[model samples]
Target: MSTNHEELTRLARTLNPQIIDEFRANRGKMKNFPGPEFLLLHTHGARSNQPRTTPLRYIKEGDTYILIAANGGAPRNPDWYYNILAHPNDVTIEVETEQLNVRATVAPPAERDRLFAEVVRQAPDFAKAQKGTSRTMPIVLLECVTEKD
Candidate 1:
C-alpha cells in the first residue's frame, strides 16, 4: 500500500467496525457518517484465505451494488479489490438488513463512465478523492447471484 493508502486503511481499521456495528444496530441505516450509502463486504484475503469484512460506500443499480476502488484516491487500488478479484464468486454483501450472495465484476467502459458519474454525483467526496491520483478509479459491481446462477 502507498502511504496514503496505508493511512486510509488505518483509519478504516479504526473506524469501520464501529460504523458497521452502528449500521447493524440501526437495522442497516447509517447515521452521522460521511459519504453515501454503505454496505458490509465480506471477502476472503487474496493470499491468506482469511475472512475479512470491509465497510464500503456503495450505489445500488437494480439488483447489483456498485463500488469504487477509490482507496481515497491512493496511487494503488485497495486490498479488497485484489481480494475480490481473487475470489470473485465467494463474496457476500450486506445491504442494510439483507445479505446478498454476489459475484464481483469490473464494469464495462460505457457503464463504468456512466455509473461512476452517477456515484460521484451522489457522493462528491469520491470526486475529490479521485483528484489526487492519476490512475482511473475502478468501478466494481457486486452482482447478485442465486444458487442456481
Candidate 2:
C-alpha cells in the first residue's frame, strides 16, 4: 500500500466525514474498506480551530479509548495528535453514534509500549507502521468524562 502523505490527506479529507457518519450510524459496524479495523476520529483542530477528522486504529481497554499516532508511520506526528496535546482537557469524539466528551493524554512510556503491543496484535499493520518511521509513535488514551445526568 502506498503511504504517500498528500494522497492520504486528500483521501481522508474527502472520505472521512462520510465514513464517520456511517460508522456512527451503524455503531462502528461500518469501517474503512480494505482496512476493516480502522475507525474515523472527529476532533477540533487546535491551531485552525476548525473541525478535523481522521481515520485511526483504536482499541478499547475497559473504558478508555486507545489510539496511536502512527500517521502511517510518518516521520512526524499527525495534526490531531498535536491538537490534543495542546489542549488536554476535554475534547469531543464520535464513535459509531456515540458522541463522547473525553480527555486526551499521551500514555506513559511503559503503558504506551504495552498498549502499542496490544494494538499491533489486533492489527498487524500497526507493526508495519511502526517500522516505516524512525519517530516513536505515541499511544494516546482518550478517557471518557462522565456527564452528570
Q: Which candidate has the top score in TM-score? A: 1
Task: Compose the digit string of candidate 1's lDDT tens values, residues 1-149.
Answer: 35867888789899988988988998778888766887999999999989999988898889889999999899999889999999999899898899889989999889898998999999998888889999889999988888513
lDDT of 2 by residue, 1-149 (tens): 65587776777688777876676677777644544255556566788877667766588999888998888777889898988886766476767657777878899999998998898888889899899889999989988887511
Task: Tell me each candidate's TM-score.
Answer: 0.92, 0.84
Q: lDDT score, residue 108, model 1? A: 86
What's the number of clashes in each of the models?
Answer: 0, 2
Global lDDT scores for all candidate models: 0.89, 0.77
Sliding window of 10 residues with minimal summed lDDT for model 1: 1-10
Model 2 / residue 42 / CA error / Å: 3.5
Looking at model 1, residue 99 earns an lDDT score of: 88
Candidate number with greatest lDDT: 1
Number of clashes found in candidate 2: 2
